[model samples]
Target: MHTPEHILIINVTRIGDTLAATPAINALHEHWPQARISVVGSPHHIEILQNLPGVVRVGALTKNSALFRGWLGAKHFDLAVVYNYDQALVRYALRVARHVVAFRQKSPAINRRLYRCVDPDAYPTVHITEHALKLPVALGIRGANGRILYRCTPDEVDRAKDRLVGRNFDGKRPLIGLQIDSFPTKSYRDWPVESFLALCRRMLARWPQAGFLIYGGPAEMPRTQWLKQQLGDSACLFAGLLSLRETAAQMALTDLYIGVDTGPTHLMSSFDIPIIGLYHPRHPARSLGPKDHPLNFSLDHPHDAAPSSEPQSMSDITVDRVFCQVEKALATRGIS
Candidate 1:
């Protein structure tokens, strides 16, 4: 086994998958403490993982970005770990690294050359965090903790604090964070907006002083606006207003989170806060759930429905089933 002096991790997936790769990155750092590590991923998510331990730098990857043809290519990394199947990224790794690791690819067999290989498709039942750590484990790097991870710089956390301080929330009252809408592409994962409004109403009835932070992106402004209007003065909108890191930093201050199975929830999973990830049949909690977290108070499709089968409606989740869990998570944290 070669001890790498410089390592490259190509994880060009979105926020959730990028956060899922943290355990593998952590393991790589533990085993090769002296190796300088660089991670290249989606432009939106790279900033979230930039300040992590052992990460020398974070770069955004794209084909026309003059990427591998530039300074990144100049660095001859001793090892490269490819986490996504994007052929462009794989080709870039092959050009700049001496040893490459990745999942097995189909015919025309570029993945056959990998020094270490694990088929992610082979482990359908395993958590994504476990699946990611498999790349490092296949290289004989053992005992890697497959927990989900994230970062919030001190300044970022203070920014969150400032937002809260302005609200003048009672310190004892719970501060909740909500991500009402999922990414447009995964809109099927979203629960009914009425269900969310009902859940908030129930929480408010219990703790009138309780505040909420509603989160989403520009694409979700309409929905966010509607929710802000419903929650009124007690709720604040975070969608399209903060950077990805800043959103996470602000989210870190929440006492609890209730959101669809989306990227920002990955940020919630990082903090020691309570998470209630609402999942529909199209996306079961088993496959893409919150990484087996201790605070994972997730609810799958209410009925025992087949995940592979397309559902006629994604609104099957009931407000009662959700409110009960929110109450339960709060009670455990002594917020009741």
Candidate 2:
């Protein structure tokens, strides 16, 4: 045990995974309240986690030279936690820390012989947040209260409202937010635009007084437009419009959110908003479901991926399957 006062976490996963890892970060902070906890991530996620409580620093891995790894290696971290156990990532941890802890994934023989490891069987069975917290749990470190907190100040909330109201979204109506894009390479996580349109159409028919807001970043604008074409003037498309902070504030007021397994779905988890989380088999319940959450509805493929099996895509998730989960989510939240 290093009695580590300064620590670093290396998580090369997406925005959702990085956010899910927060419980572990908070646990580490609780154990060493005055210690500095830093994270190395891509520039985009650095913005999300940088100013978070307990995070002392955010270092960029995407920018800087390949030799920057060598430079960071000299920082002499007291401890390092490697989330996704790639050999290159493990090697980085080994160089930076005197004590390196990693998940015990089946790896090459050389890596199997190297790192202090934890088996996955001992962790919480529900939600990625709880699963990540197991790293601290295995070491007897007390974890934070299993709540996902996004502290949006009243001013931020007011600003978000002002922005949305400017776009004619009155604060009174039930706001249902939709996320339609997954990463392009991971298109299997997406529900077809027409399917989403159908879901929205059903919601509108049921709740004519409600308003819908569609969310996505710049990369997703084209799909957002296609959804808009399907929807016509029936809904508001805020795609590529709000900053991450503003998006959080705006989503806080939402009556419900429907989307595939994406960043905003994880963000909405923090708000306690009822969510219809559409997932492919690619994102299993074991690692990425909502936690202690007020209302979470998920659609997952029954089949698990095998070495010989092809990965399942979002299109495999039928409109009817998602609509059933949506109705369940609304019922759970007592929205109707």
Candidate 3:
């Protein structure tokens, strides 16, 4: 058969896409048990892949540098798969590998011409977890599960709980983790803060015994602060309070997660937690949605208003709509 001794999977996209690529790594490991599998990722994305199975090493790619490319050439990988089409990056991959595979559409042709193109859109319209499995499928490697995989150590889980347990959360109560922010660049994907506040009000009234833990990065702290002011006693703010790994651990303890189309949302889907996804029309819920976890809920408005030039709303999905999803999640747990 068709197998390489050394394989390199390149995905320099955001953290969600980086994590989504793990299934492909697992597929390669299953296909060629002896081949060494390494991945090229950024420092931020590398944290998501750390301690993951089926990965021998993850090389960090410095911004606009030849360092990563130089290593690729030196290592001389037998096969390469480029998940996103970065022309400059593809040139580097082409130089180092005997065979190269890349996504066909929405990619730069100038860079794409250097390698074999695979069309991921031709596959079924499903969750990103399923979409990522196309990488190995296009390579004639098959029979891999579409479920997203994220593994956290037992110590990691305990450390996160210890840090945030007593202050505002009772570990015994079923917690609802809310991520109120998306990336600064993809503001369109973010749900309205007022919508979040309204949902918290309804949930607090409904689940008297339940607690809410809101999380976001440093950049989102101001918004989270504003939200806390709006929500007087309903929720506790943990924005900028924990590291990414800690946030992942906190998610593991959640009974439900409600967030925008963000990396943390994707990260939460890897665990057994139930998710209520807030999606924008521009980023359709069909392909970029969450996978088949225990319970996954998505609210999308495809024909709604368009995204503004900068950080503005994209969809017209209302607070009432999101509250309905919250009710569904609560109902799943037989809270009401």
Q: Which candidate tops TM-score?
A: 1
Which candidate number would show the highest lDDT if scored against the true structure? 1
**Residues 1-336 of candidate 3: C-alpha lDDT, one tens digit per residue:** 256898887878787888778777888888888998788777676777767666788787644753355553363788888776566566667777777877664656543553457666643355676677777887787888665677788999888777555665654355789988897887868877877877777776766666778899889988899988877655677898877888888888878899988888888888766788887766766656676567887776745245344543544677777778777776787656
Query: Candidate 2 or 3, higher TM-score?
Result: 3
- Using TM-score as the yardstick, the better of models 1 and 3 is 1
How far is each candidate from the true structure, as Cα RMSD in Å? 2.2, 4.2, 3.9
So what's the TM-score on candidate 3?
0.84
Q: Candidate 3's C-alpha lDDT?
A: 0.74
* Superposition-based RMSD of candidate 3 using all C-alpha atoms, in angstroms: 3.9
Model 1 RMSD in Å is 2.2
Q: List the residue pairs that clash in candidate 1.
A: none
Model 3: how far is 75 from its true place, Å? 4.0
* Separate clash counts for every candidate: 0, 2, 0
lDDT of 2 at 197: 83
Candidate 3, superposed: residue stretches over 4 Å from native: 71-76, 104-115, 119-131, 232-234, 302-315
Structural similarity to truth (TM-score) of each candidate: 0.93, 0.80, 0.84
- lDDT tens digits by residue: candidate 2, 92-162: 67777777777886775535644467766543346678767767776678646665555677898898888
- Shift of residue 258 alpha carbon in model 2, Å: 0.3
